[model samples]
Target: MTVPTAVLLARDDVTIRRFAERDADVRRWTELDRGGAYLALEAPELLAADVRAFFGPLASA
Candidate 1:
C-alpha cells in the first residue's frame, strides 16, 4: 500500500510519519537493516528518537 493509505488507517487523533527505506524494493515495503519489521526490538535507540521527534512538537505546545 502507499503512504497515503497507511496514514488514512491511523486514528484521526493520531499523527503519522512516513519513512521509506532507501534500499527497499520499489513495489514493496521494507525496513532498514538495523531496524526492520521489529523497529523497537531491532533498534530501540532509533525508534525512540523517531517517537520523540514525532511528539516533541506536541509536547512543547
Candidate 2:
C-alpha cells in the first residue's frame, strides 16, 4: 500500500508506530501519538483540549 493510504487508514497504534519507524516522513504522526498518549496519562485536561481542537469542527458534521 502507498504511504498516504497506509497512514490515513491505520487505526492500530502498533501498526502506526511501525510505519513511522520505517518511514521518516511519517514520523510526526507517531510523535503526535506518543505526545497524545503522554498527555492522556500526565495531563488529561490538556488532552481533552487537544481532542476538542482536533475534532471539534468535525463534531458539527
Candidate 2, residue 10: how far the Cα is off, in Å:
21
CA-lDDT, candidates in order:
0.40, 0.43
- What would the TM-scores of all predictions be? 0.43, 0.35
**Lowest lDDT block of 10, candidate 1:** 4-13
Cα lDDT of model 1 by residue, 1-61, tens digit? 3231111111122222334323232232223335455655766776666556555655676
Prediction 1 TM-score vs. true: 0.43
The residue ranges of model 2 lying beyond 4 angstroms of the native Cα positions read 1-37
lDDT, model 2, position 21: 47
lDDT by residue (1-61, candidate 2, tens digit) is: 2233112222223454664546553412322333333456655665566556555655575
User: What CA RMSD would candidate 1 show?
Assistant: 11.9
Top candidate by TM-score: 1
What's the count of clashing pairs in each model shown? Answer: 0, 0
In angstroms, the error of model 1 at 34 is: 3.5
